[model samples]
Target chain A: MSEWWTYRPSDFLLFVPRTYYRLLEHYGAGAWPWQVAALAAGLAVLVALVRGRPGALRLALALLGAGWIAVAWLFLWGRLASIAWSADYAAPAFVAQGALMIVLAALPLRAVDVSKPRRLGASALVASALAYPLLAPAMGRPWAAAEVLLLFPDPTAIATLGLLALLPAGRRAALMIAPLGWCAFQGMTLWTMGAPEAGVLLGAATVALLLPLGRTVRRRRDRAARDRPPASPGA
Target chain B: MPTTLDRRTVAAGFLAGGAAAALPRVARAQAPAPLAKTIPSTEEKIPAVGLGTWITFNVGDDADLRKDCVAVMAAFFEAGGRMIDSSPMYGSAQAVVGAGLEALGSPKPLFAAEKVWTSSDGPAQIEATRKLWGVPRFDLLQVHNLLSWEAHLDTLFAMKDAGKLRYVGVTTSEGRRHGELEKIMAAKPLDFVQLTYNPVDREAEQRLLPLARERGIAVIVNRPFQQGDLTARLEGQPLPALAEPLGATSWAQLILKFIVSHPAVTSAIPATSRVDHVRENLAAAAGPLPDEPTRTKIAAEIVKL
Candidate 1:
């Protein structure tokens, strides 16, 4: 193995930014109207997530699982691996994430209280996945380069994080491990390429991470409020 | 007493020798004769500027991009470049290069150089690489970045001994592992050694270059523009007045001219995706090279930048 320190981040950026965008364009061309299907799926998952019933939650989870599997096979393995060797290694993780989500969907799980904060965070993620295609036009790339939900990893990973965020704190953190890691990897890759999309991914990751922390802190405050003695009225 | 050769046999032998000598010369005369440096071990010459398929040729199965890569390769060969270096570590680059060669009708002058990066089954990897490039055998095979160097070198040397391989070498980039590279160069009978060397990344000059000369191992300079960082940095800057004397119009050509001008450097591989850039890079191998003093000034000017 090479001495690790000898490598800089840019050394790993094998393809240029234009090459990367072209890859997206290529994938988008091959997988058309599927973007429409993915967006519809994202909306269905959002409604199910907002409904906060175990059955609806399971449907949402199943949709996310199917999305992950599709991205793992079609995008990561079939497309990204063509240009980046490391995509082969990351593809398996996406498969595992999909498998785990599918398994979780089958399990008899309770829907966590869909509090206002949880709903907002979860909605943002699904919305982000659906809105991600806008980045193509925003970045001056043609619609052919749009990163669609379930058609690309970034949106899929981000959307998965948003879905998992709907769970109770303990289980939510546990389920987020893979998609969070993927976000970091993809974010670093885009950052190294000097692509502006890094901001979107990294920002989503930050919100995903802090969503749990914010809930935990709020829970602690509620617990303290219940445990403490009542204060003197108007004192 | 020695047996006399038959008249028919002598005539056939003469004809074979004449055809072998005449073909390459005829081809060379069609293009500008880029400066060539001889391999110390074999006395065979290769053009001083070679094409590097790092990120440039990793276009995968995109038909348009593959066609573009072929155009770049066509331009490179048209400019008299022969040696094209690539590694399996560069994703899909070997396959893309194969596509380019096939599209170009497999140019006769291709000096196919590839690196074996796997730790086990070196021969298996080499065979797979051969099928990818559609070549009978590689002109040179290198142990990439010194990974499993001991085992790979033994395999390469064995292949050379068996006449299945023409040359054996090892590569390291970004000036990493020079101490170990020097050790390998001193101990093994290497025909070529590829390492990162440019005006700015001159760490190779202190020992590796001199050691290559002493050991009679031909040096192939990689990252001749620090993988385009040097050129990008020096892009808007003025080309040193010395560049005109050396016939370098662009900074990329000037940097290439500087890299290849070193007495120890046999060839400098500059990777580029653009066909025009490949032509510009190959042009550096032609015309007058910068003198020692001019090279120093060029380096100093770059350092200042």
Candidate 2:
């Protein structure tokens, strides 16, 4: 048998890139004037988290879970799967992750407090939400072509990572897991399609992973110190 | 993944599929037969071009869209196509095919070919498919993408033995799973193998085509238009002079001819949703196949586009 390799990246593609992006275009158009409402929801989460009130993080987690579930059902299954069968498989994964987020939010874990870095992350996330509606016009795309939070992957990942970053170290790990994994997945998908946001997505995932890792290490060290017997008085 | 070969050898390598026809024929007789070719194993003659339901036939529950699918299937029969290929994984394709067959009175000589896709023993899946296609038996039952090939193969082979299925096969496309597919072809009692092969995507010509020929396995070429990429590229361009004598008029006919005319290829399945597209696609099934030299010429013409 003669040996030759003639595969191209586009050949492996199940859906046309233009067709895939057009779903977001349609979504942006459908959810019109509702962009303000989505932004308001994001602000509510931010305020709730920053206020660090009695029942804030649970409420924030519920809001986050709601976003994930909405995207899983409305965007992935309803919109994307109709065009690409591959998305059908990914839809269930999104639903599972959404459900996981809600469960993690309702649980009572270590008390989470806002730090400066957490504040920065939360502010950046809200800014991303507010900027989403303007993205299409800024990028020279047609009207209602932007990707919004809770309805698209990129902004959802950013928003989730931002919320997870604000939580105290222990709870941060659980919440970040789902969004970080999504970031990693979306990064590769965007890379294959030659989308510009691929690098940004991968970068965000790396940062998200490291943030939780740092907190976990500190928490573990504090426990180690507390558990240790007094450094030998005899010595 | 590059060859250290001259252009002539590369071109000859690609065109070799049109000349490996010494394999046994598995073709069967049909009334009012359209153009047909012999399956390398059973010598049953199937139409040169078949119907593929990858994307076109998977319209889910849309009454208006179902009418168009029915019209497309009707046009397919009118154009002398057989072997409508569907799978459970294709959303509503199997159901759509069933509905189409029903609305059309379950046209005769409809060589039903569907796949079993689950990891579990697929008797239940096969039964479901039978119910969906509304057919007594499938002409061919393949393991889709070779998913759980070992488990499904056991079920498929047993089904074939019991006379529930006419043929047993496996399908893989759009990837370099040839090593595993080739291994299964050698090991299993398979009758057919379907893979992606076209003028531009000619990697199948490398190993799968020759291996199928050597093993006397019928070859079904899927994605003949590279999932409609080649057709889109060839649109608006004048047909190559070579296409006329080979009886290819439009871009779809030209591409389908380049596929079905291959000596080792039992049939090329190019899917379409539009009745006009099916009409154009089935024309190549009856025409003179491109010879080795002509096949090379066609390949060269396509590269320039």
Candidate with maximal lDDT: 1
Using DockQ as the measure, which candidate wins? Answer: 1
**TM-score of each candidate structure, all chains considered together:** 0.91, 0.72
Chain B TM-score list for all models:
0.89, 0.87
Clashing pairs in 2: B25-B43, B26-B42, B26-B43, B26-B44, B27-B43, B27-B44, B27-B45, B28-B44, B28-B45
Clashing residue pairs, backbone N/CA/C < 3 A, model 1: none
User: Candidate 2's residue-wise lDDT over B1-305, tens digit each?
Assistant: 11011323322322342211321121222223346888877888888888898867766545556667777776676556777998877767788889777765666758899999953858888898899899999989999888888888888888888988889999988755788898998887789999988878888888888888889999988888877778878889999888888778887887777887788899888888777787677767676778788888888899889
lDDT of 1 by residue, A1-235 (tens): 6488878887888787777789899889889878888889888887877777888888888888888889989988998899898889988888888888888889888758756886798788888888999999998889988988777889988988888888766656657888888888889889988788898899999988887777679889999999999989997
**Candidate 1 TM-score restricted to chain A:** 0.92
Compared to the true structure, candidate 1 yields what TM-score? Answer: 0.91
Interface RMSD of each: 1.1, 6.3
DockQ of each: 0.64, 0.08
